[model samples]
Target: MDRLKTLMDWFDVRLGVREILRSNLQGYLLPRHVNIWYSLGAVLLALFTLQFLSGILLLVYYLPAADKAFVSVERIMNAVPYGWLIRTLHMVGSNIIVAVLLLHLLSVLFMGAYKKPRELTWLSGFGLFNLSLILCLTGYLLPWSQLSFWATTVATDAAGAVPWIGEGLVTFLRGSPSVGAGTLGRFFALHVVAFPLLFLGLVGFHLFCVRRAGISVPPFGPSARPAGVGTTFQHEVHRDGIPFFPNYTVKELAVVMFVLAGLVAITVFAPALFLPPDALEPADPFTTPDHIKPEWYFLWAYQTLKIFPSKLMGLAAQGGAMTLLALLPFLDRGEERRPFHRPLFLTLYGLGILLLLGLSIWGHRS
Candidate 1:
């Protein structure tokens, strides 16, 4: 008992136990105005943990080599008992994670939580989001399925449209003028090893900043909570919240457990899907799918490639679009965070999402 006390004391767990728990939550207690939006961050956090754990399980059964990747996935589906369940959970978990991250980002933007002290937190988060997107893209190709292989080819081919350096870029990405064995190996390395490390490092740094900044209250501030705002438990139980531990922390854990249960249930019942048998056949560089396209996230970029004319004009459009997206933090340089306040930014952001979705659909039809 004395030795345990010593360890706790050394870690400062006794003196700052409350703050330590609060450190895990990037928010203001007695948040003044709690809503469902506030819960998104917690949901996203849970999703990321789910993704990582499920991915690790899937990796044990996954074979990275081109010849074996499809076979390994098949084994997971048919032979490995709970392997299909784990693989499906990982797949669904990835989609859910991305969706939750987007929702969290939009909620922060709408609430103007990205202002002032929380800027670094927001910036690091956005960067991490972009990296996660890239990670998803790379991972999609690692399976070497018909959809995965062709999707990658079409996506990378679009990259080759850059004016002077386009050809070189394409060659580098595809490991030649075409997609083949080398492309699969490179993507597998990126998906399984490189991006995961990069993502974890960024996530750690982002969480640290959140801990330092605390959660940004809405622009209305703490005084805005009138007497009758009792829709959610957050507004009621945490209206004048206590320390994160034993209170919010307990609830958060329950929420995570619920999400985990759902994910596991899906994984066990549904499994990761495989495309048609013909699609599973070896990749044909010469042939393209009747409706060749990339994963949903890349649809917009792919569509952008289609709209622009070839040569200088097309190159300009494609390059400019990519540059704008990559430099969003720098481009969206307003101090304002609320959607109503940043009308122009919000409008453009929405339009951009729609434009991408529309283009994706249009590109496929053509």
Candidate 2:
């Protein structure tokens, strides 16, 4: 213990490690009224860290070349130690993280935590939400399996539905008119390098903004919605609020632990749920599967495209909806934060969520 303290003292002298911890860890504060839903933010952080680590371990045996990628993954599953476990965690964690991220965003929306002074936070977070989907899209192609190859084909084709630059967008993503070695190389680079870097930067900025603005007081409290102070008021840690360190941090960890347990359980008990039959087959460019569908996350959009009269219209509708979500704070500027206080918008939001869920299920079973 003494030796450890002496070593810490040596580094603390140069790095001020103790002060950094003191200020950022213990000194931070959060409203006591915040609930488990708020813990979803911490859950997301944990999920992302797990995905990042698992991806790195999988990368150790992963080959980026088109001809070798599927063989590499197959070898990882059969030859490398604990390779299947790491791959499952990375793949399953990708889906879980997106789900939790969406829930977190919805919680904030419902709580009206995206209001004034928190607008930037909301925008940055929304950007992360979209970026996470893109990360999934890029990483999906890295497997170079039949499922991934055709899914990328369908996705890039959707991108090609855009107005004038559609063809160019498709060429840029695929590096040609078709999915091949060029597509795999581009996606591998984006997944491993370009996209991850952008994600980390946005994550840093989101946390900073959240910390700067303070966690919003739950929509109901003595000081939560004081009369008409909504437009004028900004979220501030109450003087009587709890310290973020051991108090709220413990809650975050509890939630994260629960989530991690479920993730591990699913990975162990039902690995085949995600690794569908065709996913095991190598890319066969000369042949297309009878039914090609994206992973569940993109299913709602995919279903929407199929239901729409045209790909351009479906793409436009999706883009316009996302734009509204991005501009929500400005669009709904009002003197209320409590969700039920804004019944009409709340009802619409709930319906929107239900519709998306319905579409996803339809896409899956179609």
Candidate 3:
């Protein structure tokens, strides 16, 4: 312990590492009312770390070529020691991160954590959410199986619904006329390189905004609410409150560890759910699979687009919803942060959740 302290002291003298840690973490304060929901963001970072590390390992053996991708994945599952665990975790972790991200977003909504002065934080987080979906979409095609091939073909086709540049957008996405070698190469580049870099940058800015704005106290806390919390505009800066380091970091790590345990269990025990038989079949553009669909995270949008009178209308609706979510802080300038006090926002939030759930179920059944 003394040697460790001496090493830290030596580094701190030159790098000021101890002061940086003190200012950013040990000295940072969060609301005493903060709960598990607030830690979801950290949980997201943890999952992203897991996804990144596992993905690198998978990339070691992963062949991004259309002809070899499926065979390489097969070899990973069959031949490489514990490669199945890493691959399954990577695949399943992607979906789980999306689910957890949605929960974090909705929890922020429920608690009004994205209210005034923290708009930048919300915007950055929403950007991360969108980029995460793109990452998943690009990664979906990496396996180059029949499922990914046809799915990519269908998904990229939707870009053609854009008015003037639709065709160009589709071509740019696939890097050619069809989902082939060019598409695989482009998607591989995006999944491994482009999107991850953007994600990391956005994540850095998001954390900065969060720290600068300070954690928002929930409107609906227990009877022992903080002063000036009910109704009216309240500043987010907390001084005489729980220290975020030891107090909240412990809680944050506990939740992340618990969720990771569940994720590993799902990956080990139920790989079949994520790794379907379609994933085993190599790409054969001539033979389209029966009733192909996207993974569950996208089912809501998929179903919505299908039920629309026209593809353009469906795309418009989905695009408009995302725009609204991005601009929510500006549109919702309500002074009251309490859920009960803001009936209209609550109603809209509830309806949106119900609509997404209904659409997802419809899409799954369809």
Candidate 4:
């Protein structure tokens, strides 16, 4: 009993549950200048938590092998009480989470929140974004459906385009000449164990940085703090800003709760429409699906990949696109944050998105 009490005390101290709840509930702090953009991170966090829980529930029934994988999923949909709902929610939540994270990133970039003291925060977030994308890509293959199978085949084949090591790398990834049972198993392990663990660690670091630094104040505002200059708790919380106790924390909690309730309600009541089951058939090395395409998020890349010439120049185009995505931070080193200030970059971004959407349409048709 004594040891139990000691452990409990340590937990309370580490979480600051008592202090945080007391302060937040009592109205000790409030957000003075936050907007909807500030809510995306919290919303995405809630979505991720839902995805994790639903995914755990799914693992209870999912089979990793080629023969059983599709049947197992069908059983979950038809036999398991709420399995279909959970699976649908998990899929929708994954996509929604990515969308919100992108919104948060764009908002932060435009707001100039990436300026000085918060660069690490932004960097950690960038890492989180990349990790989330990987999580999505890996998870997509777990269902082992026809769509997932061909999608992986097409994607891995693209990776093989990497210069000297392309063919060898592709061979290693597929574990054979094509997408087979081995590929499914490898992707399943990565989706379930590897990516989630990395994401969990990165999430901890991301939240810690957010709490320690607090949200970035908007530039050119009355409440704006100078770059590299963070105020003391006394000044920021008690004197100048809200205490973060009752005020801001309460709002954050309210937002989280509302999002969770909404997501769960939707999942339970109205699941997203899934593709036909025929699409889940084991991938055949000989025949390709008529509409061979990627998930919506990667439509742009797939389209870009399609446009590349079969010759050396095609390899260069594909390689350069991948490198650009990987090294965006380094490529655009300008300090200016406002969209108006970076007109050229903004124009390029718009044009790129447009081209991606167009290509996705064209690829889907072809």
The residue pairs in collision within model 2 are none
Taking the tens digit of each residue's C-alpha lDDT, what string does model 1 give over 262-350?
A: 66666666443323454455555566666656655566566665676664465577568756654565556555554556678778778
Which residue runs does candidate 4 get wrong by more than 4 Å?
A: 1-31, 220-239, 253-286, 310-349, 352-366
Q: Write the per-residue lDDT of candidate 2 for residues 1-366, one digit (tens) a residue.
A: 999999989989999989888867787777777799999988999999998899889889999999899999999888998898999888889988988988998898888888887889999999999999999999999888999999999999998998899999999989988999999998999999999999999999999899877777788855667323444645465677788899989989999999999899989998787888889999999999988889998999999899999999999989999999999999988858887779998999899899999999999899
Backbone N/Cα/C clashes per model: 2, 0, 0, 7
Would you list the C-alpha lDDT of every candidate in the order shown?
A: 0.68, 0.89, 0.88, 0.72
- What is the C-alpha local distance difference test score of candidate 4? 0.72
TM-score of each: 0.78, 0.94, 0.94, 0.80
- Best by the lDDT measure: 2
Minimum summed lDDT over a 10-residue window in model 1 is located at 226-235
Tell me how candidate 3 scores on lDDT. Answer: 0.88
Please write out the lDDT profile of model 3 over residues 1-366, one tens digit for every residue: 999999999999999999899876778888777878988999999999999999999999999887789899989989999999999999999989999999999999887777777778999999999999999999999988888999899999999999999999999989998888999998999899989999999999999888776687778745534324344544466787787789889999999999999898899888888867787888898999998999898999899889999889999999999999999989987656788877898999999999999999999999
2 or 4: which has the higher TM-score? Answer: 2
Better of 1 and 2 by TM-score: 2
Task: Count steric clashes of candidate 3.
Answer: 0
